[model samples]
Target chain A: MRVTPAVELDDVSFGYRPGQRVLEGVTLRLGEGEFVAVAGPNGGGKTTLVRLILGLERPGDGRALLFGEPAHRFSQRRTLGYLAQRFELGGDAPATVREVVSAGRLAAGGLIGPMRRRDRELVAEAIERVGLSERADAPLRTLSGGQQQRAFIAKALAGEPSLLVLDEPTTGVDAETQESLAALLDRLHSELGVTIVYVSHEFGAVERFVQRLVLVRRTIVFDGSPQELPGIWHDPSHVHA
Target chain B: MLESEFMRLALGAGIVIGVLAPAVGFFLVQRRQSLIGDGIGHVAFAGVAAGILLDVSPVLTALVAAVLGGVVIEVLRSRGGTAGDQALALVFYTGIALGVVLISTAGALNVDLFQYLFGSILTVTRTDLVVIAALGAVGLATVGLLYRALAAVVVDEEGARVAGVPIGGLNIAVAALAAVTVALSMRVVGILLVAALMVLPVSAAGRMAWSMRSTFVLAMAIGLGSSLVGLTISYYADLPPGGTIVLAAAVVFGTAVVVSAARGR
Candidate 1:
């Protein structure tokens, strides 16, 4: 029996302004439990595509579906976990690692009322999964960039989402930290069997990890296995095109 | 001091503002919108002037004006572009200008800016105290009911939005609460402490709190302590309550600053 696709974009088009398409004629389907890397140059609309899939934007035409429902109207907020671009997760938020991570449960647990016992346990488990259990109570500002990123990932994990979408998770981290992060994500994907969509300009960090790679520059330029990554994507200079 | 009816009213108002300011101000300080309470206070001055001219209670008119000003600021800031803060500055200047014009028009009557700029114990009636208490309770309820979602939005708007946190509603709720605190505190501690009470205690608490809930609770404790001490000392020394209260909070803030610096932060 075939399961419903985790995400589907059928001839979807979008633009911040009319006649200025940021993404156009995009047709894609991500299977359940698949790990995919979406890469592109700056302003290449990779982020826009993920945003569309995450229900942050609406398509100008055609349908963008999440689990066979229209993406924009997908109301199971708890089922989707998102880690935004790096700079967007600033360090001066005045919250602890556990505090930020526990917020992942907000979409699962209602905004008001105390956190259920299971919610607390989930938060702790998420922190442990990211290897930051020792610094769980520390302020986010005290951590290095990679650790902070891990804290945010733990935040996403605490929700126990069925699908995890990470945008620029490796931005500003060193290569070593990036490798560790990729390893952590790979571990999470295999263990949890969640649909993972990783968006980044530097897809090489997760290149060996994602099952399929899709390149975007206002549209889908490539979609295939990592071993088949086109030569043009290997050149940083051609990325600007 | 304890025997006087006026003292009793002042202390009651103090207790309420102690609970009100930091409850809402925690989010304001976290979001770097520390100046918003002050902005609401300025617009509230215009409301006070208009109230005096129309023979209505200044607190009610100020509440209306401040909430409008707060919503306006939130809307402008929510647009999220280069023009946001500049637009807020524009509103701030215009509000005071409008108040000055209104006060001048009321010059023929016995309108004292000093009374509102710096609170008067004599002007605070039992009825005024009741008004402050009721509205303050409502503001606290708003914060308590929406604490988690509010924190999510404050820490990460886009992330919260993606999580289905109602960003617009929560932002407006915060703005509305700030307005309520400004209007109520203006009646008790004056506009000076109205804004200071929101920002200072939260700043001081930030130095020590490792978690969001701790910062929120500790800030409330500081606000409450400052309110009680400042009002009591001002009554005994015949000093300006607003200035004294703000000084009390500033002292806590200064100590916190030293603590932060000493720790190599």
Candidate 2:
């Protein structure tokens, strides 16, 4: 029997306002454990597309599915990990890194209870994986941008999600951090066999490891292996080329 | 006065409200809605007035009215900015106006209304003590059991929502807790000043907080200290406990500001 795709969008269309379209007639399917890079120019609906997959929005037309279930109605939330672009933890927020990361396990732990020992171990391992074990007790706002991103990655990793989605996870992060993030994603995808949907305008550090590269410009303009990307369209950020 | 029954009852009420206010108000201050307690308190005043007019228990009536008001404000806030602001203003004015009209209609206008508006702790009865304990218990338990979820929600609301945290339900639950806190505090601080106890202590403790848990604990301590101290001072000076408690909290907030600044935090 054929296994259900991790994510499938059938003729999806979405817009923030009525009678206007951000994306149109988009159809895509991502298999389990596939490492896909979604890139497009500025103003493109890259964020909107993934939001639909995450069930944060409904399609203006057609359907978006997660593991063959309707995206919005899917109840297995622990199976999906999402790292939002520019997630704001207040400047003076007193939440420690460990506290922030442990929230990722909320789906598994359920509401109103203590975090079990195994869950605590997973949270520790997630922090260790992101190379932030020492800073776990520090307030999240006290960390540098790159370190903060790593903590957020640890948060997503703690969930042990089958489908991991990150939206511009390295926008303001330095080159060193991007490289580390790419390595982390590589390990998460290859060794653990986790499906990754990475959305960004610049390919920056993730280009070589992605199994499939898809360009979004209102619709799917390109869908193929990274090796198949034409030299003229080498730069993912400049879609006009 | 220390040997008097009324003094003991009032102190008991003070202790209950002191612990309840800041414990439940931490999220309100963090969410930038420190004034919400004030608004809920105003609505509860109207609830008190309604109880007087209807000859029912003021605490129970205030609870129902304040909860309904809290739910309304939350729903308005979910509609996003500007709308919520306008709704708060409308609710604020209507609360006091309805309260004035109801109290006048009850013919106890100045004498009884003064007690609810500014508080007269000497009037607190055994029934009031029982009610305060029960309601305070509910508010404290909700905050205790739901601490992590509530903290997660305050940190990043959308992030928490995607993580499957019940955002809307928890928001209403906290509002209800605020309403309950307001009602429980009516005897100690009165309707006008109960929100002050809720907000000021959290603000004071916010400066010294190293983590969310630290913030919560410190806020509770600051609130308890301010309440007990204010109550003792008022008993000696023959002053209103509501005004004295608020003044004590303000003094605590000012001290916290100066101290944190001096330490370069």
Candidate 3:
């Protein structure tokens, strides 16, 4: 039997202050095993939408569901991996590369119970997947920015999440790291069948990698394959900038 | 050379504070609000002065005020209306000013404010030890139970929240813990140096270790070792216990810095 949509946001509305609707009657859905991107300008409710999905904020109206259950009641957070846009790692945090990645397994209860042999293997796999196995013993502060980002991804992947939601993971990364991350995303979605929902300011190989494109300019502008994007501008003043 | 009951009490108090200070200091450093502990310590001084004025145990007064001060600081931080540095300054000045005023008006002209300012393990009592011991046990248990969640929040608060960690509650709880440490260590390290005990040991450990758990262990070891050694040195050299302990911590901290630098970051 086919699984339901990974996430469904129905008429969700929210804002910081009263009488100011940041996201007014927004609705969207994500299917299982689908690679989707939610693209929009700054202050266009993109991050807010992600936050709603991550259960960080409650909608002012309507309902949200994840994996066919009420979002709040969905306790399978261990199966969900997220990389927020405003990522901050404790700078003076003493965590080494291996330990930092191991944090990803915290949701999986890796620290509470004894780690099985398989868990150790998975931890090593996560480190290797991030291409930082050599630096596994090093502290997080010692890594370069790109390596740190990769380590964070390793942390997210450590739980073997069914769905990976990343909000602008390539913000401060170098070109090579960005490409590598993109390639990794392709591998995760296509090869591993993990659902992917991400938001980005720019589109690279994402157009080729993503199965669906959700162009959200404060509303559901479009939700379809990337190749079907219209060449002609819908708005007269629409420019790349 | 070891015939003084006063010295024994002082040594015991110093050892207890040594463990308690670093225990709470680890989380403060983790949150990167090491200075907030200093601010709490100053507020605790006001509490101490209040106790002295009313003929009450200074430790009791300090505990009440330190907890209240910690809550106020936490409220300000969560409100996000004021800059952290500004709030810290406000709390620091108010605490010190109030302490000075109360001490002056109380007419205890013989009371040396220097002892409160510089600390004296010699002044610790059996009651003080009991209070410190109880607070220390509570702090340790809280930290142990909340270690994972605290670690998650300290590293990435929003991320931790998204990942189902209770960020706000844990933050307040940690603030309370720091306040307890501040109140307890006031007699041993003084208001000015209590924050040093928290920051120096953690920072030194962070330079060498690569995990929060390991860092905590290393900091505790360093703190305990330094405090004991400092106490012995002070006893033999006829120096102040607080100064000696702080100096020992400084020596360890200096060593860590040199080693990290030499090892090339």
Using TM-score as the measure, the top candidate is 2
Cα displacement (angstroms), candidate 3, residue B93, comes to 4.0
> How well docked is model 2, in DockQ terms?
0.52
Q: Indicate the residue-level lDDT of B86 in model 3.
A: 79
- Report residue B173 deviation for candidate 1 (angstroms): 1.0
What is candidate 3's lDDT per residue for B34-119, written digit by digit as tens?
88898898899899889889999777888999999998888777766558657867988899899888887887545477677778
In model 2, which regions exceed 4 Å deviation? Answer: A90-92, A236-241
For each candidate, report its DockQ versus the true two-chain complex: 0.52, 0.52, 0.42
Return whichever of 1 and 3 wins on lDDT. Answer: 1
As for candidate 3, its interface RMSD to one decimal place is 2.7
lDDT of 1 at B59: 79
Candidate 1 CA-lDDT value: 0.85
- Across A1-241, the per-residue lDDT of candidate 2 in tens digits comes to 9889999999999999999999999999999999999998878899999889989899999999999999988888777888888866732447889988888877777778578899899999999987899999998878998888888878888888888888998888777777778888898787779899999887757888899999999999999987888876676342222
User: After TM-score superposition, what is the CA distance of residue B68 in candidate 3 from its true location, in Å?
Assistant: 3.1
Scanning candidate 3 chain A in windows of ten residues, the lowest lDDT window is A232-241
Q: Write the candidate numbers in order of decreasing TM-score.
A: 2, 1, 3
